[model samples]
Target chain A: MLTIENLYVSINGTPLLEGINLSIGDGETVILFGPNGSGKTTLLYTIMGIGGYEVTEGRILFNDEDITHIPAYERSRKGIGMSMQRPPSIHGLKTRGLVEMCAGKRTVDVEALAKKVNLESFLDRDINLGFSGGEIKRSEILQLMAQRPKLLLFDEPESGVDVENMALVGNMARELLEGPSEPDAQHTLHDLMHERKTSGLIITHTGHILDYITADRGHVLYSGHLCCADNPKRILDHLKKYGYKECIRCLS
Target chain B: MKVDLSKYEFTGHASEKVDDLTRLDKGEKESMKMAGFDASEKNRSASFVQIDHNHAFCKSYDPGVEILPLGLALKIHEGWGDLKWKLLKPEKDEFTRLAADSTHGGYVIRVKKGAKLTAPIQSCLMMHTNKVGQNVHNIILVEEGAEAHILSGCTTTLADQTAAHIGISEFYVEKNASLTFTMIHNWGENVEVRPRSAGQVETGGIFLSNYVSLKPVKNLQMYPAITLKGAGSIARFNSVIVSTENTFMDVGNRVILDAADTRTEIISHAIASGGHIIARGHIQANCSPAKGHLECQGLLLNNGIIQAIPELDGRMEGVELSHEAAVGKIAKEELEYLMIRGMDEEEASSAIVRGFLNIDIMGLPPELKTEIDKAITESEKSMF
Candidate 1:
């Protein structure tokens, strides 16, 4: 569903990411492990078409459509959604209203959805205004639930959440990647198992999210290059045994 | 500089009084509506409607309220003569001099003691003559333990009318009383407006002022001052202005906290969309235990100028005074965040502007709040 071939990205004429080739097929979820300032967010922002992230070489193909140079809004309209690590707090823009906007033409019961995340009181509050770290993460999941994009880019879903809220965010991330716990009448149980097609590229550090959602494939992003391709849990175990420095041998 | 009053006629376009405001033509009523007047009169306890140089209508429906024109109030009430120009000096400026020289028609509204009316009193000063020089002097008195709100709308009846309006207003809130004055201005493109106003609050009194001007005015300037003369008195000024092409405005408010425990807050939101605006705010605390704050923020949509001047002064050692002022365009991160939520550039910008000028914090009644919302929407059309 998504493809980045030899992606070379930079900001302010300084190269931050180079020779990055990655793809997430339909119905596939990928977990990326990287150290801080290792061009992890730069890659995600470049994929999302955010400004100031200049794609110097190569291109990004989403469902075979060339969207490397398109604007961020256009990418959002083309079934790409991103949960920023630290999104700006827009004054006067209510969380409920923004969730509804994310749904576009589709109708969304905002209050009902907000209740699922225990964010009923935050629905009327300004977006991310004075929100705690856990509240922001839950709000991100709530917005993504409304967006219903084919491919989701979650940046550190468990970063700021407490151990109590981590379960909610992780399980919600699973629901976003896979279908809900129960399928609707339109899809049979057999169809649900085979036809579900939402994809994801989640960034996580501790791999504690693995306790809730199962990741199909994992890769360590070391020095802007994807290396150490293996099972997500095995990669997590390897990184725990020896930090990101040991993964540099895989680059050689 | 003195206004060239000779360029406009002060008389000869006499208009007859209308018993009912709804009987007016659609365009005239629309012009008044844009300025926050309610033609239906459903949400008002009393009303005062004036055409150019005529107090066409002035009446009070609630028995607890009394309304009278300036001419009648000065003659009938024995102590009202001492109230005129009491808070504001007639020689303060040329505009005040003109208003004092010929009081075309202004109203004096007084709420009786211990009366708290649910509905507001609406007053519309509409100028219809082509080049009429309209002048008015208004006064409001809230007795002890009484509470009242006044919604005043001033406008020219024509979109391109070349007229001039000069208004002088003085309000007095007695001990333990509450008074809220909300003024909306929708003058035409060629219209020049000058409003001079001042107020005083007694012991334990509360004074709240809300000013909104979203339409075009060639030249406009006003700076109303309120003095808290008694202990525990409080005052706040909330102003939102949107100036478009060919418009120029110099508007602000000043509050003086002279008594112990008195507090004041002055906040203004100014937006310049290809026009020039000078937004000013000042607060002074002269006694211990007094507190005051001033905030003036400006947003520039395009090629225009926005000057925000906020001043705070403290006289006594125990007094607290502070201020914050900023003038710039919308933050880039704020715009991009909205755009990625599925809205295009224009839609995102409009949302930001509406939020920047949001009036939900002003505590306006439902009727006047709807008027300000409509004005914000209309002003958005000129921005893009």
Candidate 2:
């Protein structure tokens, strides 16, 4: 459902992502593994059409629509949603208010949705203000659920979360990527192992997200390039045994 | 009392609205509505709707409280041929004398001992006639162990009417009494207001003053003072002002702690859009074992100007006082963050401005707090 062909991104005239080619088919989920500063975030932001991530030379298509030059908000309106790793705090905007906006035209039971993620108490509070790591992650997931975007982007969902919170985050991410389920529908890891007509591009370095949602493919992004694409288990095993240094060697 | 009006001269000080005392205009009720006053309410009423020195209506709701016209209150409280500016006797300057000398009529509110009045005594003072000076003297007296709440609103009916309002209010909170006074001003663009008020809190008494001015006024200058005269008295001032479209406003609050173990706090939030506002907050701790704190915050939109001056003086050995003041525009990071949440630039800016004005002042009645919040939100919507 999402495709990036020969995407080259620059920030302030400095090349960040160079000639990256990636695609995730309909109902397919992909895992992107990269080390620190390997342009993983740049790729997600470029796809979401955020400012300052200038696409020097590339084309981005979602559902066969060329969205290479669309603005960020328009992209959001066109069913593109992202969960940032470190989203900034909005001083006065309440968490529930943002969720309501994201659920535009959709009669969403926001209170129940927040309660499912144990975020009901925080709905009235300022968005991301003084929230813990686990709380922020939960808040982001709650917003994404409210958005119900056709193509979802997840950035380091497992980072800075505890074991219990990681379980919660992983389960929620799996259900969202699985398809539209009833508000009361309960899905286990086995249910998410089988994919449906919902696509996602997840960025992770530790491969812990694989514990809940089984990805269809995994690609190694090194030095702003998609080095290789292979089976998800093979890539995780390779990274666990040899680390990203092997990927760099392969690139050279 | 003769007021020397040498230094207090302005351009239109020559002509004053003569006492024609025209009947109440329909537009007067509309102006009252703009100031958030409803005439149909029965429990708490606008004891006096004085329109440019005319006593429109007056009433008292309960036996524990007394609301009377200024003329009748003066004659009754002072007896015949007695000079009884007892509580609000003019002192210090010619401005007080001017208010005392040129004032036509005002309202008198009194709460008897041990009376806990839940409903707020509402007062609406409006200006309808053009080129008129509405000068009045108000007195609020709360006897020992009494508790009361007063809501006063001031507004002008016509947008082009050039009027001046000078009011002097004196309050007395007896021992163990508490009084909460809230004043909301919705003035016209060409109106000028000068309100001078002072209160004395006796032992174990509490006095709270909340002021909100939202609409555009030609000029407004007010300095309200409260003296904690008895031991363990407390005083607090919570003010929110929005200056828009080239209006000039200078407002201040002063608290004097004259007895031992007294406490005081002053909080002022000012938002200026193309206008100028200067907020001066002062606290003087004259007795031992007293504490005071002053906080002032200003948000400037566009080319508006704001100056915050917080002064603290501790004369005794055991007095502790602290103050903090900040003035700036909204943070860029906050703006971008809200934009990412699907709010446009204007929506995000208005949200921040409204939040900046929404300060949490302690010990306000829930209904009053809600009213203030609604007013702030409405003002924000109509500002741009």
iRMSD for every model: 1.2, 2.6
Instruction: Candidate 2: give the clashing pairs.
Output: none
TM-scores, each model vs. reference? 0.95, 0.81
RMSD of each: 2.0, 5.4
Query: How do the residues B135-160 of candidate 2 rate in per-residue lDDT, one tens digit apiece?
Result: 77788889899998888888888878
Report the C-alpha displacement of residue A81, candidate 1, in angstroms: 0.9
lDDT tens readout by residue for model 1, B1-384: 246888988777667988888898898888888887888888688999888997888889898799998889888999998999889887887778877777787899999999998888889998998999988889899999999988899989876899999988998999999998889898878998889988999999999998889988988988899999999999988888889998999999999898999999898888999989998888888898999888888899878799888878788899988888888888878777776777778888998888778887767777767877888898899888
User: Which residue runs does candidate 1 get wrong by more than 4 Å?
Assistant: A183-189, A249-252, B365-368
lDDT of 1 by residue, A75-112 (tens): 88988888888988876778988899889899999998
True contacts kept of 2: 0.27
- Candidate lDDT scores, in order, read 0.87, 0.79
Docking quality category of candidate 2 according to DockQ thresholds: acceptable
Q: Local error of candidate 2 at A129, Å?
A: 4.0
Score residue B232 of candidate 2 by CA lDDT. Answer: 98
